[model samples]
Target: MPDQPVDQTTPRRGSRLSVDDWLEAATQILVDDGIDALKISRLSARLGVTKGSFYWHFTDIGALKSALAEHCRQSQATAASRIEALASLPPVERVEAMARLLSDPRRWAMESALRRWAVTDESIAASVDQLDCRIFAIAISAMRELGFSETEAHARATTLLYAGIGYVHAHGRLNEATVDDLHVIIEILTRR
Candidate 1:
C-alpha cells in the first residue's frame, strides 16, 4: 500500500522549505510510495519544515495537486516533443522511435504514477484525459496522412495510445516474447 498521508505537524528545525523543495519532496513521496501516501504533514516533515510552509506555497492540497499535475504535464510535453522529433525520420523509423520513447524507464515511471493518481483524483484524471486527447489527435492526423480514412485513423490512433500506455506500464512484466508481440502489433496497426 502507499505510505500514509503526510504528517502535517510542526517542523523539526531549520529554515522553511521552498516551493521547489516541497514539490520535489512530494514527487519523491509519490514515486516511492504512491499518491495515497502523499500527505501535507508528511511532506512538510520530509522537507524538515513545518506544515505552515506548505501553505506559503499552496492554498491547500488541491493547489498542490494542481502544481503536481502541471509538472507532470510539462514533463510529458517535453518527452512528446522528443518523440516527435525522432519520429520524423521515416514511417518505418517512427515505430522504433515510439518504442524507444515508451520503453524509457523514467517516462514509464512518471506516466504510470500520473495514471494511478488520476484514478482517484478527478482533476488529475481530467488533465490526463485532455493530454490523451491531444496526443490521439496528433496520432490520428499522422495516420490520416498515411492513407487511412478519417474514422479508421481515429480508431488506429486510439489503439496506438492504449497499446503504448499498456506497453510502458507492463514493462518488467513481459519477456522476450513481448518485443515479438509488439512487432506483430505494430505491423498490424501501422500497415496501410
Candidate 2:
C-alpha cells in the first residue's frame, strides 16, 4: 500500500503549536527536570507533538536555549515593571510587594534551574547575572525613595537581595508564614 499523505499544517491531534507554547513547555521541563532534560525529543513528547513541530518553531537546540533565556529575561523585566509601577506606594510597601513577587514558587523554581544551568553554560550565566543586577537596581531605587542616600540604598538593597534569594532557596515554597517573615525582614531593612 502507498503511504498516506501527511498533513504538514496541523499538528498532532489537530492542535497547532506556537513558539510560546514550545517555550513554555521548555521552561516547565527545565524547571521540573534539569537542563539535560530539555532536549527536543522530550519537549516534543511533552507538547504532544513531533520533532518536526519543534523544528518548525526553533532552528535547533541552541536556538531553543537562547529563546528560553530570553523568555526568562522578559519575565524578570515584567516583575521589575510591577515593582516600578508601585513607585507611588511607600518604599516599605514597595519592598513588601517586591518580596511577595520574588517569593512565588514558580519563579523560585525557574531561578533555581537557571542557576544550575549557569554553572555549566557561560552564556546562561551572563543572562542570570544581568537579571540579578536588574533586580538589585529595582530594590536600590525603592530604597532610595525611602530617603536613604545612594550609597546606603545600594548597601541595603544588596543585603536585602541576597537575603531574599537565600530565603527563597531555603523555603522553595512560600506560605503565609514565609510571607510574614519576609515582611519582617523588609521592615528591618527599611527601618530608619
Candidate 3:
C-alpha cells in the first residue's frame, strides 16, 4: 500500500497510524476474516489505535472500501514496467521465474481473498479482471522471451497461467504442489 501523507492535525508521534496503515489493517481484516469484518471499530482495535485515527484518514467505511478498490487497481498498473524488468533478465531465467508463479503462498492467499470479494462487488470484480489480463500479458511476455511466436506464446502462457491460478484458488483446501511437481512443470514449459 502506498503511504498517503498523514493529516497535519494527527499527532506526529505515538500510535499515529497513517492512511496506509488503516488500509493495510482493513486488508488484513478483509483477507483473514471477510469484508463484513471490516468495521472501523474492529480495525482500529486491531491496530491498537482509536477510531479518531481511522476517521482522520477516511470519512467512512465506504470511502475506505473505495480506496481499497482503487488501491487494487493502482497496484497492478505496473505491468509494463514489470515486463521491461523481466525483459532485462536472460530469457531462460526470466521464463523460469515467471513460470514459478505459485511459489509465493502469501500472494496466493491475498489473490484468493480478492477473488472471493470480487464475487459480491462489481468494482472489485472489474479490478480483478483487469489484474488477471495484466498478469496474463506478463506471462505472454515471458513466453515471447523464449522465442515463441505470438500465437504459440498465448497458448503456452494461457495454459501455464491458468494452471497457476487454479492451484492458488484451490490451495487452501488442497495439498500444495510438491517441488517435483513444479520441477516437471517448469521443465516442460521452458522446453524449446
Candidate 1: worst 10 consecutive residues by lDDT?
4-13
Per-residue alpha-carbon lDDT of model 2 for 1-192, expressed as tens digits?
A: 999776553345448888988888888888888888889988887777778878988899999998987887677667657756766677777778777877776677777887788888887787777767766877898888889998899999999889766755665465433667777788888988
Off by over 4 Å in 3: 1-14, 78-80, 141-152
Which pairs clash in the backbone of model 2? none
Clash count (model 3, backbone only)? 0
Q: Tens-digit lDDT track for model 1 on 1-192?
A: 987665554234676666777778778777777888888998876777677878989999878877987777677677667666754565545654566566666666677788888888776677677657655655676677678898888888889889878865775577422567667876787788
Reference-based TM-score, model 3:
0.75
- Per-residue lDDT tens digits of candidate 3, residues 1-192? 999877653344356687787778778888888787889899877776677878888899999998987776665455334534665667566656654543567667777777888899898788777766766776777778888998988888788778777877877799987767877876687678
Descending-lDDT candidate ranking:
2, 3, 1
TM-scores, one per candidate: 0.70, 0.77, 0.75
RMSD of 3: 7.0
- So what's the TM-score on candidate 1? 0.70
> How high is the lDDT of residue 62 in model 1?
74
Candidate 2 lDDT:
0.78
Q: What is the lDDT of residue 61 in candidate 3?
A: 96
Evaluation by lDDT, superior candidate among 1 and 2: 2
lDDT of 1 at 50: 74
**Each prediction's RMSD to truth:** 6.4, 5.9, 7.0
